[model samples]
Target: MADPTSLLPQPNREEDPETPSNNLHHSLDQIIEQSEASFGWNQFLQSILVSLASLFDGTQTFISVYTDATPTWHCTSGTTTCNSSSDICDLSTSDWAWDSISSKTIISDWNLQCSSSFITGLPASSYFMGGVIGGLLLGTLADSSLGRKRLLVISCITMSVAAFATIFSTNVWIYSALRFVSGIGRSCISTCVLVLLMERVGRKWRPRVGIMQFFFFTLGFLSLPAIAYINRANSWRALYLCTSIPAMLYCFLLQFFVKESPRWLFMNGRGEEAIAILKKSALSNPNSEFNSVLLSADLLSQVPESTKSIDPYKSMKDLFAKKWAMKRTLIVMVLGFGIGMVYYGMPLGVGNLGFNIYLSVMFNALLEIPSYPLTLIILEKWSRKLSVLWFCLVSGICGVVCAVVGDKQKVIRIVLELASFFCSRTAWNLISMFTVELFPTCVRNSATSLLRQSYILSAVFSSMLVSVGSSNGFLSYGVFGVAIFVSGFFVAFLPDTRGGTLCDTMDEQERKESMILG
Candidate 1:
């Protein structure tokens, strides 16, 4: 076991005699690296706010399933036979008896059963495609001009407005267009929240903090079935309002509740403000001693005196400037594209299995509860590379199994789907953390945003495939199986990031592997 005392700075190590000041001479990350020990109240407070954003992300991610659901239908008394395989609405509602008392979904409300496939999948696909465009355009601002707090606030408010507008969508064209706008506006929420949450704590607490955010996200996903079930027979507008109202309220609460990160502030040369925040943190956790003067001096040495002059695009450009950095990003992006198909496709395709759609969605969401805790365990004790690789391979097999299970055996098919969901969730959760660690603090947001965009881009194509292949098991899960397994094989080429300190700058990240080897 490592010595507990080594975590703290030792007075005897080397005293740099003060010429005119008495202060610890280390960088901002160095100070946290040496001094941070426990998960403090300040970090906990920040996490509550960040995890709330994750809840919103989870809500937005699968909200389309509810709002755009293909509604339950029945045929009128002697008009025509109720053949589900064909459009039941083709016969005018006047001839066919309307089964339901109200409009159950956009699909039913607009009589889209006879609509083209592209038109049917447009809303969800456009939302994802918009995410790809939005993340690339706005996500960089978090690492540069806007900082994490403002970006999160903006994203939440944007999603709320879009959800509100969607309640009054006049046509499919209008609804699909608004979803694209919402996707672009709220695209930075997950990436910004993840980065801001981690920056609030020391490296030792990062894995725990990350898992905690995911736990909140899983809870959000679980809430959907309950909300949707309650309004299942009612107009889909009701579900949209339920999710939107709370999200709008959360945006307002953010102003009074959230604080900007001291690390980000200091890194940008806002030393005095950073010191003020650190003092608040020091008080919040009385056990941790914070020497503000010493920390401020360290901050001054690292950040240029004039932070205002820094280029806004510097962080984005830095991502491509280094060969290793570029390679690392490209390889991980390829893997993310594969994971994306399964991650988003699983729950969306659950209803296509000819089972009870509500029950199937709930069952899939249930597995996420255990998956996140299990992810925390793997992150702490196992090789991060192996964790991702093995989980991917296992999930792939589960997907293929799901494809082979006959529709007659619904229970067996559901079991394989749940197994596939479990493995995929674990792998995706770990991949989020692994990618965060692989890059430096400076461009971490941009790098992660890029990976997220890759995932969203894949979802654009995969969403269409799953929809068109709703009745064909092999086309959906089978394709997912092959893609994930291929990504798993590439994991062998990457280095294990566990058992080492997180790098705070690109230079440190570039030197990380060589230092570990030496």
Candidate 2:
């Protein structure tokens, strides 16, 4: 493998006693020219599109399985087949039985579906736990080692392979293990897809790009129900196999087309390669006036002098040192945690509320589409703090109303559900954008990844809460409402990043502070 550091930009230098000091200036001129010839709008869009492919991979892997029947409540026929004509055996619905059946069915629809003789709900919960672990581990990997493009490609390949492997599991244990692996890949892909988009796109375009990311994600989400509805008659294994097809295609497309982020390259100190990439990018743009020397000079000027001596680890430590950093981190962390609880909790809670599970999830996901536009409008016209605060408050209040209305009042339930969906979706969109802005670029990925992990970690707790709340009426929704309401208070602490330039280094922050004080 190429040296990772080689991807970053380096300053120009000359080595010889005869060389004048001006020789360094001449070299800087050439570097700037090269950098200018490299950047273009097409390169930016293409890189983002490729990175976003992982989002589709995640959606496919996540929603393939659905609840059908319970193990203890099985129909007595000694025969396990649910769809005899399709030769698909009905797997046990007991927590263990469900996983084993889903796993085996995904592997291949055989005549006899395996039963979970010893498996239980604990194993079922393990699948989710595995997802949490996967999101954190892979998310960190994406930030630390694998550049976004490589990480995304790898995630799709592994997720596809794991999804396919799920079809062949012999028992619940194997099935659960495979799902866990798939979850890890899915989490990594999802997190990186967002991180990569935000990092690569221009500051002015981040919100719109984020909207596009989720828009495509919603496209995947919409496709899932249709796939499920169409394949409902087939064995469950067929669903896993079918969804894996897109990921395989994405893997092929990414290998040949995707480019790494220039910003990431610069940060890593691969000035030469970063310049090379910019040259390629500029050439790709028909409208661009390509000037390699000018680009090189510009880049050289921007390159920090002491970067060679700087420690990446120390950069991270500085993120929490000041009141502003500490305050932003705490607020975003709480926002993620609360959003995770509500975002995941709502769908599960709605299902338990005796509504049409499919319609509820679909409608909730559909609501997210409008949020992108709403976000764009709010971000442009309203302050970031105000936009986030308004959305959180609305969503929280609606969630509380949803809880109080109950299932008996159909009209009231429908209205509250729709309102809750809109609020929650908007809140999450703002939170994602806000988190990206809170930290400086050097440690942005690390900080965002850690905060996001807090969200995923909170999800595990939400899952447990859902399980407990399922036994009592209105408890899950009520608890979810309370959590979201509390999250709104933290939104007040978040800074307004609207109209702010991307903070590439702490010096930028210092400069801004100085200007404000002056």
Candidate 3:
């Protein structure tokens, strides 16, 4: 067993004395880390319960792929100007019609096949735009006031309500508006959930648990194809209804099964509550020999007065207040933007793959399964910086090749597209886990949310590109390749965080930095 006193800071006799609050926080960090070393059934249950949110997020996000797709059309029996090769926009409305009922998809229901790219892309763009708004406005609450569990429940419920209400939309405008609202709610689910899961586990288990969260996301994404295919003959509203109901029920499950992150509690000055939860977790694990004496009320009382108060908006302000945090934030966001462009864009743009949309999307979604384990290995065995850089490079190369090969070489184009998407997804998983490790818990969610927002912001443009690329391939695939490739180089500026201790405060982070420099 490690010496408890040695885990804490010593008295400073130098010019700059280390504050009592800092030492207390350092002791708490060490205590928490030690207690979390053994993963038990209790932690496993908690990890799974928290990860399910990603399932719904993935479901609602890609449901748009099928719900908004323009169904295949054919000419009416005797139409003079309409034929198999005819552009639907060039023919009279009466001369040609969609194979599926018009109500099956938004494109056919709203007669958007002939609409401008901007109009066709508006709903998806609005949804991503709402994510931007939600991330900026609501994300900070997790770190500062509401705490991780409450914010997660709120975000999930909000998303579910918005998604359920979308079934009532009467026009494309209303539909887009509801999607925007859903985006706001969804913007924080993955971020909060990811942070909460990481904080709950030990450093040894953190990467694996984080990857498990993505596994649920993959499960949610995989369900979309089967759900959409089953509801292909039904109205698009059926898909929303199916996805929303389960998500609302999931909110209830979260309430009953989930616990607030202990790290967030400690940071927000609820040391007693944090200790209780940690004790409970340690008790649940048979291998853990946690010392009950280490978590006394006296330890809680020693927490600095400055750390005891909750400032609801201070988290975001703190990000900009520090120069290192600011520079780190900008670099990661730029990297996130490029990965986001390809991450969300490829699934939505599966329509342009010159194959059946269902099969095309399934192929892409199926590829994501292997990427998670592969990413886990890469993170475990290699440097985060190198994994990110190479994944981006390979994804970009495949994307550009897909564009250059064109649709005529159908098999080659599809294979390259899948390869590109696969690599991008791997990079996406890496950067997300990487971002969490980069920032201290003090502003972790805020930093992650900002990264997510950057991705969503880029997705807004990706929506437009996908719409335009339905007719022009270079805009989507070619641009996606170039963007990610250029962005990958930025990883060189970031420090490798493979085995660093997770910091709980900005002060702690600064101390670690100073140690490394001197």
Reference-based TM-score of each model: 0.91, 0.77, 0.94
Stretches of model 3 off by over 4 angstroms after superposition = 1-22, 304-311
Span of 10 residues, lowest total lDDT, candidate 1: 16-25
Write the residue-wise lDDT of candidate 1 on 1-518 in tens digits.
33222344543323321111112223455455433446666768778877897787787778877777676665555544545554554566654444564477788788786777688889999889888998988888887888878888998888878988988998899999888988886788888877777776766788888887788778788899999989877888888788888988999778678988766776676767766776666665555656543433434554535345678768888888998888888878888888887888878888778888889888888889998778888888999898899989988998888888888888888888888778888888888888887887678888888888888887887777778767688888888877887887777777777755556567666555664565
lDDT of 2: 0.59
lDDT of each: 0.76, 0.59, 0.85
Weakest ten-residue segment in model 3 by summed lDDT: 12-21
> Candidate 2 residues 47-136, lDDT tens each?
456645745653553362242222121233445454222222433433123323332333223222333312322223454566567655
Q: How accurate is candidate 1 locally (lDDT)?
A: 0.76
Model 3 collision count:
0
RMSD of each: 4.8, 8.9, 3.7
In terms of lDDT, model 3 sits at: 0.85
Candidate 3, residues 245-284: lDDT per residue as tens digits? 9999999999888999888887777767777788888886
- Give the Cα RMSD of candidate 3: 3.7
